[model samples]
Target: MNTPEPAYTPINCDYYDRLEAWATMRTVCLLKFYDEEGKEHEVSAVIKDLYVLNKAEYLLADNGLVIRLDRLIAVNNIPVPQSC
Candidate 1:
């Protein structure tokens, strides 16, 4: 049986803006986030795009990783706030 995806929590507006900026500038960043199994992972990649899918927001990395906005832990050492 397939497990349902966790409910999407909206991230901070400022962080969202930063992600957009990074995507626009093609700035490589260290992205820290949790996976479906709640395992933490990190990657250094440029943000390629930000888009919405099925009422959830996501960021695409140049390395071909797509991370849900709410799963992000940090971007370049700046922590993602728990509250939006």
Candidate 2:
């Protein structure tokens, strides 16, 4: 089996912090994040819901997509700013 190249490096805390803001404000944008196997994925949708389970935070999109925050690489093509 061929190993997959790392598609996304870990992002900063500011990015994760903004995720809740986006969800709360219902922002629509393309979200880029990595899956458990390190494969990257993107989706164009509005932030519809967010919840935490088992100590992991997840971002739920209006289009029925869910992504874990730690795997996120970028939002709307912008790199995550440094955590404050």
Candidate 3:
């Protein structure tokens, strides 16, 4: 027996998306915040040196400190950010 997951967990969603050329340079990411309820969240971490391809799944790692993007759901290309 084990505890069930909450209805909603707060995890910051940050990832790159669909791009023909920059596909190999993009990555999916997630971050947990202190304000989050239950003090826990689910999110994928940065991939290793190897470029993360499509259809990768994420697994919890580093004592839950980090989440790895082993599988990807979807990719969307957004404009890169620029400094002021």
Cα-based lDDT for every prediction:
0.92, 0.73, 0.32
Q: Quick one: ranking by TM-score, best first?
A: 1, 2, 3
Q: All candidates' TM-scores?
A: 0.95, 0.70, 0.21
Q: What is the lDDT, from 0 to 100, of the residue 58 in candidate 2? A: 75
How many angstroms is residue 68 displaced in model 2 relative to the true structure, after the best TM-score fit? 0.7
The TM-score of candidate 2 is 0.70
Name model 3 segments beyond 4 Å from true.
5-30, 33-37, 40-45, 49-84
Candidate achieving the largest TM-score? 1
Give the worst 10-residue stretch by lDDT in candidate 3.
Answer: 75-84
Q: Which residue window of length 10 is worst by lDDT in model 1?
A: 75-84
lDDT of 2 by residue, 2-84 (tens): 68543333336666667778878888878887777879888889988777766666778898888866676778897655334
Model 3 residue 73 CA deviation in Å: 17
RMSD of each: 0.9, 4.7, 10.6
Inter-residue clash pairs, candidate 1: none
